[model samples]
Target: MISKTTIDRVFETARLEEVIGDFVQLKKSGANFKGLSPFTDERTPSFMVSPVKQIWKDFSSGKGGNVVAFLMEHEHFTYPEAIKYLAKKYNIEVEETERTDEQKQEADERESMYLVSEFAQRHFADMLWNSELGKAIGLTYFKERGFTPETIKKFGLGYCLDQWDGFTNAALDKGYRLSYLEKTGLTIVKPDPNNPNGTRKFDRFKGRVMFPIHSMSGRVLGFGGRILTNDKKAAKYLNSPESDIYHKSKVLYGIFYAKKAIAKEDNCFLVEGYTDVIQLHQRGLENVVSSSGTALTPEQIRLINRLTKNITVLFDGDAAGLRASLRGIDLILEQGMNVKVCTFPEGEDPDSFAKNNELEDIVGYLEGNAKDFIQFKANLLAKEAANDPIKRAETVRDIVNSIAKIPDGIKQEIYIQECAGIMNVSESVLFSTLAQIGKKESTEASKKQRQEQKAFDVVKNDATVEKVDVQYELERKIIEILLLYGNNTEKFEDLVLKESETGELVLEPESVEAKVYEKIYLDLQEDEIELANERFRTIYYKLIEALNQSENFSLSTFLGSLDQEMVSEVSSIMMEEEKYTLHNWERKDIYPKDKKIGVAQLTSETILTLRCFLIKKRMSALQGETREGTQDNRETLEEIMNYIQLNKLLNQKLNRVLS
Candidate 1:
């Protein structure tokens, strides 16, 4: 267990905005930063980070919390992992209690596999730098591709020996379990009963150059190996098989190292080969990664979305290959991501082209040559359709389909006009074609959505229904009032209420708002039923617990413990009531400022709001009618009037106190 002191230090030192800003492209929105939702596919910004509050919220997905919570959600890290991540980020040393041998032995198979994979990554990395064979084989290959020693080390590139059991023997001698080795596909194990100890073993990447694939959090998942020999029987490139922890479709190469640069540049260079990524980063273009030569996938695009939205794909100038690679552009557009394309000079790929040019020249070339997806498509297709009406019409539909993948309606309209001008077709005809494509897409999308919704409804329908209570609206209002105004004690009726004991009346102190909330909470506690809305229920329980624990309750501390949805809901109410305030209460220079409203008045006013709201709700639920425009025959009106009068007094007391 990590010491509580270290955990607290991690939280205090890790700024919410700074940590999240590394992955999310945040823009100023009033008092907070807003960006496209990282957890969902959306064009508008619904993800918000409040620096003043030291928290973040994703309105689209209803996920919100402090810095620790963001890492936990975004990286799929456990609570302890999140704290350790923070400690690493802020340079705080973690203090963990020593575990016993028996406790260590209790590690599950998956965790053990993770440990083995991690150790293998370190071992390979070590060999790359310190071993003679590794330097000659691995470092030589990386340097041949123009990677600096620092760059090679940063990417964890390495090479395993031609000797059959070198890595396997070292791992076993270090006490790593053989079972985990086989499970991770790092060691090839075969059955053998001949020697009684008898399973033959060899390293999976024997005599091959290694490229470490990493998760977003920088943990090594698996390896991609390249062969040095031109053996016809063996494949040129091989990747680790899917295992307990590694999923190829979901992992993007160099994301762990390139995330910060990607966010800083607000663009990612997508290439095909591992060497291409290394060479580009070596040339000082740090914000680049590869698909490991796999075709683009939605999962891969989502990984990029976690850091950026703009992608520039680099392709070789070979026309046939470039045309085949052009299929990925549609996938990028489908995810609502911005895309640009740049093809290198003939006979050169990213690796060779980057090596032959200086950083400034390469950057300038990219800037001048890069074209938007629409223009690139038009240039490629226009030449093929010269004076051929049938091919030209098909080409127009192809472009229109690509345009329809965009999520923003306004952007679609703008692109449509541009495409019309370029194609020399009328805007109306292009718009009509776009509309037809859009209709087809909408129909297909709706069908898929309905299927998903049906599955969700089936599971949801199993639970019993609870209708919203009309009285609860009034209760909610009262709670909001108490939260905002409960601190001002002077606004309440300070007159002591007397109670008769047998024959005489006795005086006692009173707090109207606290008393009201207490009565409501106690009444509900007796029924043992929670509120229907999750946020409201959680807030109610927390307030009740706080009230029960101490004589003084701090609302800010209570609000801090809530999740993002509750905070937004509560903040919306609190802010609506508390936005305007008089400055320098002591210098207001109004008489009787000495008699400032205390906690009682604010609490009472808030409670009064709740009571009135609840009363009105109850009346509505009972289908009761009000005597409109008349003060007589109006018991319900009388209750509402009392609430209004109390609220007016509360505001007056607040102003007077501040003055």
Candidate 2:
């Protein structure tokens, strides 16, 4: 377990915006920052971070918390892992013991696989640097590829030995388990009738240079290994098979290194392999990532979409089977992003071009040569259809189909005009083709919608409508006030029961000066009321106790002491209204009342409303008791009547007329 001291140090040193900025691109908005929600697929910025409060809220997914909470949610990290990640980032030394073999064995399957993958990354890097065979073969191969020492080290390139079971034995001797190695696809296990254990293990990437594939947060999930020798039998490159943590389809090769630069540049250069990304980065083009040779996937496109809406895909002109790769551009268009295609000159791919040219030359070439996807597609297809009327017509329709995939109608029309001009086709004919495609797509979409609605229609019709949760809203408001203004001292009006001149019981509002938390605590205690929600009940006393104990309270420090769930709850409550502040409310001449100005009024009304709500609840219980005969009717009736009078008086003080 991490010590409290280290946790405090992490919470203090780790800036929420700086840490979150590594993942999402944040823009300044009204003393806060807003970005696209990483937790959801969104174009508009809904994820908010408040540096003052040291909390973040994703208005789309409704996930909100502090720095650690964001990591836990976004990176899917365990608490300790998140703390360690921050500590490593901020250069803080964590005070914790390393896990023993038994502890490692006891970890859940996924974590164990992670542990093995991380260990394998280190082991392979050590082999690349230290082992003689690794130096002569793996290091030589990387050096020959024109990768510098810094570039190789930056990517954590490594080497695995050729001998079968070489890695497996080394891992076993180091107290690592074979189960994890096999699970991570680092070790292949097969039954062997000649072996003593009736099974044999072989290194999956034997005699290969290793490239560790990482999550965007920099967790080593798997590795890609390239063989050096010209072996006719063995495959050229092998990747760790789909494991619990690594999905090749979803993992970008250089994303861990490229996400920041991509967001900063506001453009993403999409390449086809690992070397292309690294070589480009080495040549000062940092906003580049590779699809790692997998067919482009929507999940991967969404990952890049989270960072930017512009994708420039570089294709190898000299490579075989080039037409198949053009489909990825259509996928990009479907995601509503602007895509451009740049192809290398004959006999040059991204790797070779970067290796040969200077940074300025490369940047100029890319800028000058990057053609819009529609133009690229039309030109490429138009040449193949030369002198064939049917093929030319088909090419026009194909370009139109690609245009139709765009979600934005305006962009589609613009691309349609561009295509018509390029193909020398009439704009009206192109619009007709687009309309036909749109109509067919809309028909199919409506059919799916109706089919899905059929399944939910009966349930929707039979489901009873629920009224607004008044108590929940009230409790939430109370918590919100406590979180935002608990430490604030404000003068409040205290309602005291007194005899009016006519001898009738009435509420007299009088002035009182007390801290906001003190007023809330005393009033709730006077009524002997408790919050109905379990989570709220836990947050209430703990929050009140902390407020009373500290004269100089820090929200970041207080949040550090609570568990993650409570931290998230408190963050959501505290930052709820700031979400609106981050939007364009002021531009429309709309403004919310300043929270500081109405602190006293808000506190008093919440307490009074809570009191009235609790009184009604008790009265309701009494009325139910009278109906069930669970208690004496006379006492129950008298008790209910007293509560009714108190409720009416409290509501009257609140300017509420009770019927």
Candidate 3:
């Protein structure tokens, strides 16, 4: 477990903008920073980061939280993992107590896989640097590929010895379990013939150079190993098998290194292999990542989509390579991202091209040669369909399919016109084909929606019904007031009922000043009202405790003590009104009434509303009891009359007119 002091220090030292800016491209907007929502597909910037509050909100997705919460949400990190990541980023020393054997055994399965992967990364890196055979072979291969020592180290490049059990033995000796080793695919285990009840283990990436594939936060999720020897029976490159921590289809190689660069450049260079990413990054082009030679998946595209909206796919000039990668362009287009294709000279791929040229030449070549996806596709396919009517017709349909993938109507029409001119076909024909494709896609989409709706209705009908708590919103509002204005002292007017000279009860108003927290606590206690939401109730007591203990309460300090869920709820409530501030209301000739101006009235009204609601509920229960004859008839009658009068008084205090 991480010590409280270390966690506090981390929260203090880590700046919200600096931490989030690593993954998001933030542009200054007044007092806060705004960016396109990483949690959703958005053209407009809806993600707001408030450095003053040390919290961020994605208005698009309705997720708001502090720094640690963002990491947990975006990177899928555990709490301790998030703290450790921040400590490393800010250069703060993490103080953690050693886990007992039982505690170690109780670690989460995903965390265990991560720990094993991290151990493998370190072991391989140490072998590459410290072992003689590793240096002689793996180091030689990397250096021969024109990768510098710094580049290799930066990427955590490493080597595994050729002996079958080298890595497996070392890991076992380190007290790492063989079960995790097999789960992470670092050690391959099989049934042993010599021992009846025992199993044999060997290294999975034996005789290979290792490339650690990391998540966005730099946790080693898996590894890709390239074989040093030319073994015809073995594949050239081997990747970690699917496990609790690693899913290849959802991961992009070099994302940990390239995320910031991709955000900074507002563009990404998509390539085919791990070396392609390292080599390009080594050559000062840092915004490059690889699919690791697999077809691009929507999950991977969404990963990049969080960073930027423009993707320039770098293809080798090989015809087969170009054709295989062209399919990825449509996927990119479908994601509402701009797609450009840049092919290297006839013989050179990104690796060789970057290694052979200076940075300026390579950069200039990319900028000058990159073609729009439509033009690139048309030109490449036109060459193959040259003078063949049937092939050309098929090519036209293929181009139309790519065009139809575009979500924007204007873009599709423009691309269609461009395709018509490129194929020497009529615009009418292209339009007709695009319409047919769009209609077919719409029909398929509707069918899928109907099927989904049917399933949803079945589940909805079969699921246990939950009673909606009508007091929830009122309870939530009261909590919001406490969190935002709890410590604030303001003048409040209280209405009191007193005996007049004629011996009749008359309403009178008295002005008083008190801290908001004190007023709220007294009001709720007087009425015996408790927060209906369990989470809200927990936060309420904590806030009251903080208020009672501290004369000078710090929002940031108080926030650090709460869990992620509370942090999110508090931030949402705090920033709920600030969303209007983002609209620049005054500039648009629309001025929103500021709630802070009547903080006392808002607090008093919220409490009064809750009191009124509870009174009505009591009255209803009394009426039901009277009908059921479960209570004394006279007592129930008197209780109902008292509740009615109390409800009327609350409504009057709330300035509600009687119907």
Best by TM-score: 2
Per-residue lDDT tens digits for candidate 2, residues 1-659, read 68889999998899999999888888889889988888877767898999999999999999999999999898878888899999999999999867777875566777778888989999999999999998999999999999999999999999999999899999999988888899999999999988767888899999999999999999999999998889989888899999889898888999999999998899999998889999999999999999998889988998888778899999997767766888888889888899999999999999999999999999999999999998999999999999899999999988999999999989988999999899999999999999999999999999999999998998899999999988999999998888889999898888889988998789887998898899998888887888999999898888898899998877888899899989988988988888887668999999878878999999998888878877887888878888988545897898888788888888877888777
> Which candidate, 1 or 3, has the higher lDDT?
3
Query: How many pairs of residues collide in each model?
Result: 17, 0, 0
Global Cα RMSD, each model = 9.3, 2.0, 2.9
Worst 10 residues of 3 by lDDT: 575-584
Candidate 1 regions exceeding 4 Å error are: 105-111, 193-198, 386-389, 421-424, 445-465, 469-496, 499-602, 605-659
Model 2 residue 30 distance off true place after TM-score fit, in angstroms:
2.8
| TM-score between candidate 3 and the true structure | 0.92
Q: Per-residue alpha-carbon lDDT of model 3 for 309-418, expressed as tens digits?
A: 89999988774766767888888988888999999888889999999999999999999999999999999999999999999999999999999988899999899889
| RMSD in angstroms between candidate 1 and the native structure over all alpha carbons | 9.3
TM-score of 1: 0.75
TM-score of each prediction: 0.75, 0.96, 0.92
Error of 3 at 653 (Å): 2.9
Segments of candidate 2 deviating more than 4 angstroms: 97-106, 195-197, 578-583, 625-638
Tens-digit lDDT string for candidate 1 (1-659): 77877776776677778888876788766566777677887766777776765667776786766676787677666566778888898899999998789978876666677789889888888887789988888778877777888888888888877778899999999999888888888999987768776789989888888898988778788899888878888888888889977888878888887889998888999988888888888889989988997888888887787678899998887645666677789889888889999989888888898899999999999999999999898778888899999999988888888888888788788888888988889989989988888788789999999999999999898978888665566456545644544333232443243556774333344544334356455435653545656667777777667666755655535554565456656655543321111122335664332112444444444444444445445555433446343445456666656544444444443343212
Enumerate residue pairs that collide in model 3: none
Off by over 4 Å in 3: 25-52, 56-64, 451-468, 568-592, 625-636
Model 2 CA RMSD to the hidden true structure, in angstroms: 2.0
